[model samples]
Target: MEILADQTPLPDAIDERLRSQLTFVIEVDRLKTVLRQSPLAAAPRRENDAEHSWHLAMMVVLLAEHSDEPIDVGHTIRLVLVHDLVEIYAGDTPLYSASTDQQEREEAAADRLFGLLPPDQAVAMRALWDEFEARVTPEARFAKAMDRLQPLLLNWMARGGTWKSPGVTADVVRARKAVIGEASSALWEAGQVLIDEGERRGWSRSGS
Candidate 1:
């Protein structure tokens, strides 16, 4: 028996608008290759930017009620989903490491990546990404909270996840998660419990 294949002619009807959108769709697939420091909850392997974004999006839905202020959950979800798309070019910077140049690099990545879409979509996506970074709007704040929370939750679940790294200390975790309290005191409390537990269990380094 011969192997069968569907031979189809090229559809010339596709236009530049759609071609640009498709190009962007293909380009963003690279986000899966941008590895992050946080490990997956279900496994030991490090998570990637794509997985991190989807995880935060789901977390926003699951934990929306915990936000201290009323937020547009839909808009918040959009923020989480697109917030890290720039990492496709800039790569994931470890949460514990601070780099003065990180924001500039990510801004350039955002400009190039979002620029792949049509003008209106490019503008909308860029705005969402920027809003999340700015953390000014209620939705942005809540989205930022969830983005911080998800990795912490994963670390807790994975028994210290990235906290085992040499430079990661309890103080570092506390400082990094401070924004969670600003958005959701309830979620912040929950994160505190995990941090305390991690310290107790030796999953995180304690202050000497």
Candidate 2:
């Protein structure tokens, strides 16, 4: 008797768009342009787009214990994680970098990056992404605030200032924190203490 032969046959390949899940590879490569860790950390030191997103995601989890407004932690976390994908196209702006045309440039970059998805997803992602960009809603505003707050916290603890490396002042730190603090008063209060201490100790680029 002849040995039985296997009759397995491969299924037809699925196209990228046809599958329920879509690939947004375009955004992935472009994301390399975004920088994190700020100029204060390495003088030109920067974390990649992926690292920056993860840092925000972790902050949502770590800082949850400190939020006072009964925020939707889940949504807040999600908001932070996805907010910065625009950097892939627009690149990360220096915290204190001045620009009259920055907003328009970022909006265009967002359109290109988020527009890569299929129609429905394009709309959904673009909406959430825009929410983070606009910082109007509670979620967007809170997440945006934290976005700035986290890095500042690090620089403060390290006795460094990314913006200060150029010409940032104590007032500038206060102003940057103001936008984020407005989103969550409690977070703002907690952050203020850090700023005060930073100033008291002369926590500039030296972190001393």
Candidate 3:
């Protein structure tokens, strides 16, 4: 039996624009190496930035109806997917860990990583990331809600996975959940149920 080879060389006629886009695509694969504090729902190992972003994108699709304001689902999905590409360079910062310079580091990483694409594409992606960070637009708000919700669901599924961390308190969890409420009151109510359950189980600290 002959074995089929899967690898293929790039076309000789590929343009510089396509080359740049492909370069950016290959570079972002590094996001798989940037692990997060939140573990997978059923797996013992932590999820990487790539997995987290993909999960959030799916959540945007499934939960868009819960958003308080109407949102452009495609744009919201774009925000979640591109929001964490900076982590490919800046690295993941655990939610409970203090990092005074995290914003500065991530901003620099965004500049360098996003710059790898064609000019127009780079600007467009960078704008999505910026909009997500700003959290002012309806799509950004809903996207950010899913960003927080994904980990929260994982923690609950893992029986307070990262909530067991030393510095993570019920107050901290509630504070984070506030963003969910800003996006969707129904989602916030659901999150509060999990928070209450976590508190009862003693998986989360009671006070701030």
Candidate 4:
């Protein structure tokens, strides 16, 4: 039998223009996010962009068994990992910020960060980022649903509104879950369960 070899290009020094890629690694201290619970089992009260991405990566690996839908687990994992790379440039946006101009700002930030890579890498990465943003494809939808669901679960488990620093209400939480419904009815139902229990037990404030 003849052998078929894999062909892949080796990575060389990425060049000067790719310096924009370093923005993601520049460590934006202003990008604070997700409050931590002092007693989070194995990992306690550690909140940062790196930690958030790490958790999302693990969520894709560990909770995938409960997806209730066949999906590319690897792709889901990648999406979660790359989803927030833009935060490096755009900075983290609070979930409940009253500012009416966030969308435009974040979108512009996405352009700057994703546009920094090599043309090919930048295109692929941007497409994946955009797909995650659009939340229309099956993989993208599932990924987005989890992105929202995880914080809510963490806050509830963290003893109520730990991450909802701006004040989260049951109705507001429900509205967040409502979008998940369009993505996956099953996961959305699960979100409802979490939200309902959170409200009943005061993990999230009711009618706040």
Candidate 5:
């Protein structure tokens, strides 16, 4: 068995370009350490940023058909993969937690993390992250849909995972998750069914 370590030496023949690329790749490994509030269905521990991004990428592949408009699945996958790399430095901000400085922290993290790559690759990576943040493109919108839907599914499976938090209610969940409908009506409708059922089961409260 082998472990991945940033200290591993690169070949002497590797140029500065490849060196920078590998450095950026190693830096992103830190995302695995940044955990989120959503718990894994099979485990009590919370999921990490890396796992969440991977899940979104897979969701993009499997659920692109549900998007409101046509989207390039590959591009959307790139959006999901790049979306959370900033959390390597910015850290995960729970969806329900209020944070006035999250955007500021993430922007700084993006600059430092993405800057580790070669200039061209850095620009491309930053572009993907920015596009996802903007949520303007069809792929970006659908990527966001998958991002929101993943946690919603996880919470339902965990019997109101995040919904168990103080002040979280069915209405709050639906309001926060309504963005899912902006990209995928089908998923939003399905999510609404889950929220309604969750409230009925007392997994979540009726109001704040």
Candidate 6:
């Protein structure tokens, strides 16, 4: 499918708004190509951005009751879905990669990808992405928690997945996964239990 730029003319048969929407739909399909650091439980390859986002969305539906505060599950799902769409352009930045300019890179990607939509949709999609990043609302906080939790689950199942990568230690996992507590104390406690077990099993590296 040809992704026409904003200035490009649309075919007479289709509306400009529909053309822009379709272009955006096609563009975001690239998200399936952006691979993440966390390995999948059922597959040998690492999970892609699309799979990660979908898993988080399902987590919101199944685990919303564990959220510290009441949240709109529907809105939380939307937050998770939009959260990673920018990765299509910015590429997945591994949690432990420690890249200093991640926010800047993602912000620019958000602009370009969301700009593919019509004016109103562009604003709405950008708003969802920003909300997920800010994590101020209950839904946003819960969505962010699920985002952190998903990788933790994967890594644990993968016998330390990214946890086995260089520079990662039990302490680093604790520090990175602490955000899960901000949304759900229950999930945070469970994740801590997993880390403890992982450490004992030699699956996770030790020391700070």
Predictions in order: lDDT: 0.86, 0.67, 0.87, 0.65, 0.90, 0.91
Deviation in Å, model 2, residue 131 alpha carbon: 1.1
In model 1, which regions exceed 4 Å deviation?
1-12
Question: Lowest summed-lDDT stretch of 10 residues in model 4?
Answer: 1-10
| Cα deviation of 198, candidate 6, in Å | 0.3
Clashing pairs in 1: none
What candidate 4 gets wrong by more than 4 Å, as runs, is 1-46, 162-167
Stretches of model 6 off by over 4 angstroms after superposition: 1-10
Question: Using alpha carbons, what is the TM-score of model 5?
Answer: 0.94
Cα error, residue 202 of model 3, in Å, equals 1.0
lDDT of 5 by residue, 34-90 (tens): 999999988889999999999999999899998889999999999999999888778
Give one digit per residue, the lDDT tens place, for model 2 in 1-208: 1111112322338565543233464335445656664533445465676766777888887776665456777887778777777776666776777867767777887787666667787788778877787777676777887787878766764676563566676677878678866666777887777877777777643232
Give lDDT tens digits, candidate 4, residues 1-208: 1111112322346555544345333433224553332224345554676567667778777766666566788998888877876676566676665767766877887777655466777788878888888876777777877777777666766766543445668887787667666656776788888888877886767884
Q: Give the TM-score of candidate 6.
A: 0.95
Candidate 1 overall lDDT versus native: 0.86
Model 5: weakest 10-residue lDDT segment is: 1-10
- Residue range 70-149, candidate 1, lDDT tens digits: 98888899999899999888878888886778999999999888888899999999999999999999899999888889
TM-score sort, best first: 6, 5, 3, 1, 2, 4
Per-candidate Cα RMSD to the true structure, in Å, reads 5.5, 9.2, 5.1, 9.0, 3.0, 2.3
Clashes of each: 0, 3, 0, 0, 0, 0
lDDT of 3 by residue, 9-72 (tens): 3465879788778767777878888989998977889999999999999999999999999999
C-alpha TM-scores of all predictions: 0.91, 0.79, 0.93, 0.74, 0.94, 0.95
* lDDT rank order: 6, 5, 3, 1, 2, 4
